[model samples]
Target: MSSEAFRAGDRPVRISVQIAPQHLPIAELRDAAVHAEDLGVDMVMNWDHFYPLSGDPDGLHFEAWTQLAQWAEATERVELGPLVNCNSYRNPNLQADMARTVDHISGGRFVFGTGSGWAQRDYDEYGYPFGTVGSRLDALAHDLPIVRDRWTRLNPAPVRRIPILIGGAGEQKTLRIVAEHADIWHSFVAPDELGRKLDVLQRHAETVGRDVADIEIGNELRGADDAKAAALFDAGVRLFTIGVSGPEIDWAPVERWVRWRDAKNG
Candidate 1:
């Protein structure tokens, strides 16, 4: 699919919720996903991590790809994926294969959101090398093509052209990678920082002969209010996401954001 499709902000606002798989039981997490779908969320997401990012250091946490596979079976309408997958955790070819299988399972609702690995604890515990940021980004820049090439060779193929969402805003390397491979760029930078980073991304896109506007803009609304979200939308962010952590998943914020999205799209 060409990245030059619907500009989400100009068309409809999409709201995705990342239900963090920490401090919660499996049954509850499954139920939460079902409920989110029923509540009309546009997308559902989880993090790729071995331990809790906050709260208890060793709190209960589920792996990402496994849970994502389960979600593909459980929910029917909402698109689902890792909020941002760590590229270093699995081989690029394996990641492509897993993604293709899940895309089939979901009937083409998969969005391949990924990034270079970062969590030191995850690396130490799992025994993957903890390299410098530049090296990690270089690895990601290298692996994305392998993932794409594997996608083409897989039997039965992906249900559709799977969307690649790259998360990060490093102007030099990360943005350049987004320009090259990502259909969606998850710019975690605040609204004020978007223009400059986008300019950098555009420069990179120019070098590759792709349209920079072809990439959709995404942002997190975890610490944002309506005004902030509106500002981001005004600045061209069409994908708004909020993360809810478990064992006490809050539904109110999800509802609020859904309503906000509805209002914006209205």
Candidate 2:
């Protein structure tokens, strides 16, 4: 798929909330997912980390995929998945089957966002090999196909073709993988920087004989206002996400962005 192909489709503006699985109780996480859906966000995401990323290293934390299963059942209208599941953590086939079950649980609303593992602590604590970035990327490249294959072989297949979302912007390996496989590509780049990264992605897509435009561009929403959002929109980003970590989630920005998405999509 090419950039033109993606642009040819009706890519509407969408808002996603990343309910960070740290510093909160499971019930709070559940409520947060429910509330984000109630407020009309398009999707809800969680990060795949066994440990907290900020404040106390050993704060209240929860597993990503398991909790997402809960979110799938708890929410009626929002899409649910991890923003990027670590490819290194679980076998690709198992991951695929898990994704299939979750898609079933959600009536086919799972986005299988994934990436090469990065956090050394996640590997250290869990006893997985903490390899170099290149090695991890290599592993991701190798396993992704198997995941897709397994999705086909499952007994009762996914309710729909689960969208594969690849996160990160490593110009060489990562973007190339995105060009070849992802239905969505996510990154945390600024609007000014997004164009260049996208240009790189496009070149990679051309090399891979796929349409860069077919991959929906996704970005984070912290420090973003209407102007910034517009700039990113101009750069081809349609999925805007905000991260909320909690004892209590602040829904003010979610409400604001949901309105922004509605106005734009409408």
Candidate 3:
């Protein structure tokens, strides 16, 4: 898709902060959510996992959607969601209900970010099926539309049409699902890989008769690299995210990205 096709007038480059919830106290996590909003972050995200991805797996952890409920009550400005909630964790209808409730709690400031299950540890420890990638992606493809449909049928519908963000770079099933269901597509690939993934997504969009430009591109930042961000911006990514772990949350990188966003806006 051409960049011009996706361009909105003066849309500021958005920076997001993903808080590693496993390592922090709930109170501290709440405080961090408030602080992130205070710091002018475009969005705040938490990972969906039963154990810590970094540090000790047994150290500390929190559930994704529950934390999001607290965040919705705690913050006023920043949009919030799980970076990617595993599709196998809950019933699709239940997930939609939870997201809709949170959307109402935040007064329509929520993004429904989801993904096909990964992380063998989470599945194994939590007793969720540790299926093959293909199987998980298949489950995701089936569940996404169910979630969307459930949102419409629920007694109190979502405060807004919650934007769906599908996170992954799988060339076949995952990207195809993103093209079909996602309003935002989040991936962790490098710039070159992102270019290829965009091609895959475009191909999928063509098959579905949808415009690839309708989906927003989101990428995780490896570090503070303006040149790299520029490269990604050129590749059609507008949302850039950085992950920070607690109890020593580093706001430096986030601050730098905010500055970079401001400069880009100027």
User: TM-score for all predictions?
Assistant: 0.96, 0.96, 0.96
Error of 1 at 9 (Å): 4.6
Q: 130, model 3: CA deviation in Å?
A: 1.0
Indicate the residue-level lDDT of 63 in model 2.
Answer: 96
Q: Answer with 1 or 3, whichever has the higher TM-score.
A: 3
Tens digit of per-residue lDDT, candidate 3, span 204-255: 9999988878888899885748788988888778899989888688888888
RMSD of each: 2.7, 1.8, 1.4
What lDDT is reached at residue 194 by model 2? 80
TM-score, prediction 1? 0.96
**For model 3, what is the C-alpha lDDT against the true structure?**
0.88
Candidate 1, residues 190-235: lDDT per residue as tens digits?
8887767776877899999997777888889997987898778877
The global Cα lDDT (0 to 1) of model 2 is 0.90
Highest lDDT scorer: 2
Model 3 TM-score, all chains together = 0.96
Q: How high is the CA lDDT of each candidate model?
A: 0.88, 0.90, 0.88
Model 3: per-residue Cα lDDT at residue 20? 89
